[model samples]
Target: MAEKVLMKGNEAIAEAAIAAGCRHYFGYPITPQTEIAAYMAKRMPKIGGVFLQAESEVSAVNMVIGAASAGVRVMTSSSSPGISLKSEGLSYMAGCDLPALIVNVQRGGPGLGGIQPSQSDYFQATRGGGHGDYHMLVLAPNSVQEMAQLTIQGFALAEKYRMPCMLLADGTMGQMMEPVELPDSAPEMAEKPWALTGTGLSRKHNIINSLSLTPDELERWNIDRYARYAKVEADEVMYEEYLTEDADVCVVGYGIAARVARNAVNAARAKGIKAGMFRPITLWPFPKAALNKLATTCRAFISVELSMGQLIEDVELAIRCSRPVTLCNRTGGMIPSPEQVLASIEEAAAKLN
Candidate 1:
């Protein structure tokens, strides 16, 4: 049996990235996620890995782009605003078809809102924060264990798709401690013939760039990238369904909000409300087909989130408006309590009768 160690979510992500054969980490410090940088700084030197705290978030992400272009497992972490700073670099990586891991341990924000946890970055993450027709694989971890597990998975997925992956966590998950079993060995990485390694006078040199002055060429690149995204959408949708077999009302959430919604699901059950919980593990390439299928049986959905009705939009779209969806949320660093979510579920139930 694998031994379990107690770790905070941020620390778990750092350790897991190292275990996943990530030898390069470049990031700037920010509230709610600085522990990730601190952990990497302490461990990387001993293992012959590189951990450089860049001067700014912009520089950190561009550093990731450089490492990723050379075909290495690289990662960077920050909070909401820091992620926004990295958005252009993210688009560049996507345009260049380079793979790397980006972590966002979210804090409140449109503009440095607060240092407390918030999921308001849903639109930012899933919609590709930068100006481009591209997408990043976004994984939301609900617990410290998932934090570690998803970090490893994010690296693998990024490499496989040749694009960026974001681990979308919030402050509560970043600071919370739990027992977690980490992997003992790193997974084998795929060869990157497309990487810009020096030719050494043996073959043609590889070039990595996102610029295409020709309109037709740029259009083709966008179309091709989206084709890859279509494959990802088809194959990589991950979600969790709980007590949904006979549910009339479904509670939808992700990350920290999902954790609270699970408790509310149990409470709603006790109160004779057929409420189940649907947690989206992947925010992008969302489990639309699964939710649409559930809409056939479930009469309504309650989207519980730490943002003001952001996740509810996706819920309604997923169900194709076949069923009504309500939002139960708190924004600006406040979390919705289990009782609050349960009240929303009860309200949905009452309306169904």
Candidate 2:
């Protein structure tokens, strides 16, 4: 039986991770996401799991790497600046092909910008934050409900692909309260044949390292990883479309901004305007095909965001510049209102008329 519970997104993420059998969590407390660490600190010990408050984000990510290398499901989380610190570790995990979950409850900034919701980390996440060519299977949630769902999915995808997966959220999604049904079909984690959990049969010792001294070997490794990434792109694109049939205007966004765009779409529909929403759930895989299809039907596309038009570039590229793509956004902890989005939609509709 599935139980319905009202929870903040952060609480739901922690609870869902526990239910998914995550036994280790290491993180440093940060704004809009501290509740996750706090929740785990209180609950992990009771459940016979490990929770450590590391000294810094770098240390926290390294701790997760250590736990994951031991063949256990492990995780850590942070906001923008902290995520920046964890980039080195993230690349290490990706390079070594460690299965771990990382959550970014995004806030504004290139620096310690603000403790408000922002999608400024889109490029950082999709581009693989640190260095080297790698990608984190990134999931974006439009609601608190989806936030819980994606956290669990992040772990699954990470383990399945032997890569780090990220739950890319924002302060709005993290703090919003919503009713969610926990997953009923939780699978038991399979034995990790590759994990270095002190192999009993010492046929050969194991090592997990991101460093490659030789150029030829490193090039081959990069090629192999890109092959894996290609498979991921082909197999993993998730998104949602609302009233897209014969639409004249398409609103593209994710997380909190996407939810606001939903309302704006409905309002525009009420006014007899053909409006729709194209929300990307997997931010890295980024529903390009859907956006292209919508571009064929809609006269214009509006890339609504909580940051200054970061996702707008992707939307334009996906549609191949066949139609005009406009940007509607706010920055530095400010949330664009539904009315404001509706006005943007109205303006776009006028451009078509």
Candidate 3:
């Protein structure tokens, strides 16, 4: 039997990556997320893995690109401000189809926001933070267990899709502690036949780059990438529904806000209000089909977040105005409460009746 241990979310992410066979990690120091780099530093040496603390976030992500191109499993961790610096590198990884893991223990954003947890980076993670037509597979975990499990799985998804992946966790999730049962052993990594390891005596050398200087070639490359993105969307859309079947109002949220919304649903139900919660586990795919289906029945929807209604855009897009969707959020490091979500639900439900 695997022993369960209480762990903070950020530390869990680090251990989980190591257990997922990640032998290399390069990341700069950042608030609310430094634990990830610290853990890697403490453990990687014992495992004979490379744990490099680069001079800056930009340097760190670029190093990851170099390592990943050589066919090694690699990762990087940062908060919102640091992530912004790495955006260009993230874009390059996407363009070249390199598989790497990027963990953003989100903090208030725009610029050196704050160390406190915040969801302000929702758009950047889901909308391809870099300047290109590529999408990174995003996993949003609301619990310590999922934090570890998702960290393990993010690597596989990135390798499977041949692209970078972001594990979008808020500061609260990273700082909080909970019991988690980690994997018994490192997961088996796929063979990188396309990796640029070496061609010593191989028939041909492997090339990795996001650049296609020719316009027509770049267009073809982009079109092909979108085809793969569509496939990922079809296969990877993930979300969780809580008592939404007969509810009059559905509250949609993720991460910490989702946790609060769950409590709000329970309280609303106790008060005889038919309310439910929908958690989008994958922020990217966004689970449009399931949400659209729910919109056909629910009287209204409330999109909750720790940011000023950033997620509402996706919720509105998902429902296509089939139902009225309102936002209940807090920004600049403020946390959302269950009472606030319930109030928003009551407000939305009132509009319905």
Candidate 4:
């Protein structure tokens, strides 16, 4: 039987990670996402799991890497600045093909930006945040309920693909409370044949390192990783559309921005404006197909975001620039109100007409 619980999005993620068989967690506390670490600290040891607060984000992610290399389900989480610090570990994890879950409850960016919720990391998560040509599976959850679901799904996908899966969220979603039906504890997965556990008599010693001395070897590694990414792009894209059928305008958004956009769509509908929403759940393997289809029907697209035009560019690319994509956004900790969204929709509709 499933249990309904009222939980903050960050708390739900911590609980869901435990239910998903993640017994190892390492993280540093950062704004708007600190509840996740706090929840883990309280709940992890009670379940006989280990939760460690490392000295810094770099060490925290490296700890996750160490745990994952030992074949344990491991996770780490942070906001934007902390994630920036962890990018070195992220790149190394990618190179080693380590299965880990790293949640970035995104906030404003560049430097020691504000603690307010922001989706400014779209480029960072989609295009490799760190150096080197590698990708992380980036999942964006628009609601607290989705925060739980995607965190569990993220672990499974990471293990299956031997890659890091990131749950990219923002402050609004992280701090908001919502009802969620928790998933049951997943069955213990069988041993991974490819994991870097001690190699016995059957094979040679396994070493996990990102450094490649030769240029040819490095180039070949890049090609191989990209091939894996291409497969993910084909199989892993996820999104949601509301009132898209017969709509003249589509609002593109994800994370909390999607929820606000939905409210605006509802307001637009009440006024007889054919406005709809197209939300990309997997921000990295973006929902290009759905957006392209909407382009054929919708006269214009409005991108609602917590940052200025980060996701708007992707919408433009997906639609092949056949239609204009307008930006409706707030930055530096400000959230766009439903009224603002409604106004944006009205403006877009007028422009299209």
Candidate 5:
């Protein structure tokens, strides 16, 4: 067994990306996620990797596109506002069907809100963020271990589907410290035949671009890309169900919110409230099937979030509004306490009677 080491969540993500065979990292430092760039800067050179801090988030993400075009394992990290600047690059990567890892360690909201933790970017992440008909695989990690584990998984899933992947974590998850077991070996990378490597007169030249002049041609490309997304939806939906065998009230959450919900569920359970927790690990390919199934048995649901009721919308959509869903959330970098969630759970239980 690999020995566990105590490390901050941001550092774990950096180390895990390295373990996943990422050799190129281009990012600009931002609050809550700067540790990722700092770690990469100090360690990338010693391990024959490249870590370049660009002048701006826009420049860094464009650099990611360049590296990905060469069919190399590449990554970039940023916070909420920084991610906004990279939205254009994200769309271009999706249009080109380029695979790369992007990390968003979220902080407070709409415009340079605050440096405190927030899940306000949930919609931005799961909705593809930029202009286009596309989606990126979004992974939410609650713990330092998951922060590391999901980084490796994000790289594999992105390469498999030939699209960008985002690690959506909150400021708390980025700054929190915990024990994690790093990968024992580096992962094997996939071959990219379409890469823009020189032909050496051995074959036809390769082209990597997102441009399509014809409207019908662009339509077909979007359709085909969605077909691949459907496959991912079918095969890659990941989530966790806790103490839900006969739960009457279900609490839904993800990332740091899920961590808090777990504690609330425990408290409710001790009080004989029969509460359970459902946590989505993959926000894009949401565990819709699983959540819909839970709706059949659970009478009501409470969405715990660090945003103003963002995750609740998905819960309602997943269950098709069959069961009553309520929101228990805090915005502007505020977090819901266990006692608060317990009160919501109790209220839900009472209403079911």
Candidate 6:
């Protein structure tokens, strides 16, 4: 049997990145997510991989862009404020069609907010974080184990789509410790024929860029990218439907909040409420089809979140007004209690009476 070791979520993610063939890690120090960089700094040199502590989050993300363009697997991590600083670089990577992994171990924020857990970066991750019509592949993990698993998978998804993939984790998930089994070997990387490695008389030099000075050229690029996004939406939507098949009250959540809602759902079921949870594993894809199917049978929805009701909008949009959606959440680093989510579920069920 594979050994299961206790590890912090941040450390687990760093080890997982290495296991995913990520040879370069560029990051600046930030709370909640600093451990990921620390782990990389400790291990990357020993493994012959690069670990660069950049001057700022912006610099770190750009460093990832440069390394990724050179046909190497690379990653960067930060918290909410740091992610905000890296937004421009993220957009640029999307435009250039670079495959890279980004981890935002989220903290409370609008500005330089608290160093505690928060899910407020949902908008930044699910929507286009920076300018233009682009979306990063976003994965939300509910546990420390899933943090490692998703980090491994996120790298594959990014390489598959030739886009940046983000693990949208909260500070609690980053700092929390749990048992996880490490991968025995790194996943093999696919060749990047278009990578900007030196051609050296074998072939023509490759140019990796997101710039087009001509209007028509830029329009064509945008259209082509949108077509790829449409394909991604079709093929990559992922979710977990817990007791939703016969549910009357559907509770929607993701990441740490999903873990909380799972317990609330069990409690609701014990109390004779037909409660369930729909967890969005892939946030950008949003699991709309599954939610729409359940909306046909469910009476109401309760969105459990660790932010000021950020996931509620997506839930409402997914159900398309077929069922009323209620918000149960806490913001500014406060985690929602299972009892609070259970109360929301019961209240939604009572609305039918």
- TM-score for each predicted model, relative to the true structure: 0.98, 0.97, 0.98, 0.96, 0.99, 0.98
Let me know the TM-score candidate 1 reaches against the reference structure: 0.98
Reference-based TM-score, model 6: 0.98
* Count of steric clashes across candidates, in order: 0, 0, 0, 0, 0, 0
Model 6 weakest 10-residue run by lDDT: 182-191
Write model 4 residue lDDT over 262-328, tens digit each, in one string: 9999999999999999999998888888799889988899999988788998999999999988999
Across 1-353, the per-residue lDDT of candidate 5 in tens digits comes to: 54988999999999999998898999999998999999999999999999999999999999999999999999999999999999999999999999999999999988999999999999999997899999999999999999999999999999999999999998999999999999877667778998888899999999888999999999999999999999999999999999888999999999998888999999999998899999999999999999999998999999999998788899999999999999999888889999999999999999989
Q: Report, for every candidate in turn, its global Cα lDDT versus the true structure.
A: 0.94, 0.90, 0.91, 0.90, 0.94, 0.92
RMSD in Å for model 3: 1.1
TM-score of 4: 0.96
Point out where model 6 deviates above 4 Å. none
Show where candidate 3 strays beyond 4 Å: none
Residue 245, model 1: lDDT of 89
Model 5: lowest-lDDT 10 consecutive positions:
183-192
TM-score winner, 2 or 4 = 2
Instruction: Give the Cα error of residue 297 in candidate 1, in Å.
Output: 0.4
Model 3 whole-model lDDT (C-alpha atoms): 0.91
Of candidates 4 and 3, the better by lDDT: 3
**True lDDT of residue 169, candidate 6:** 98
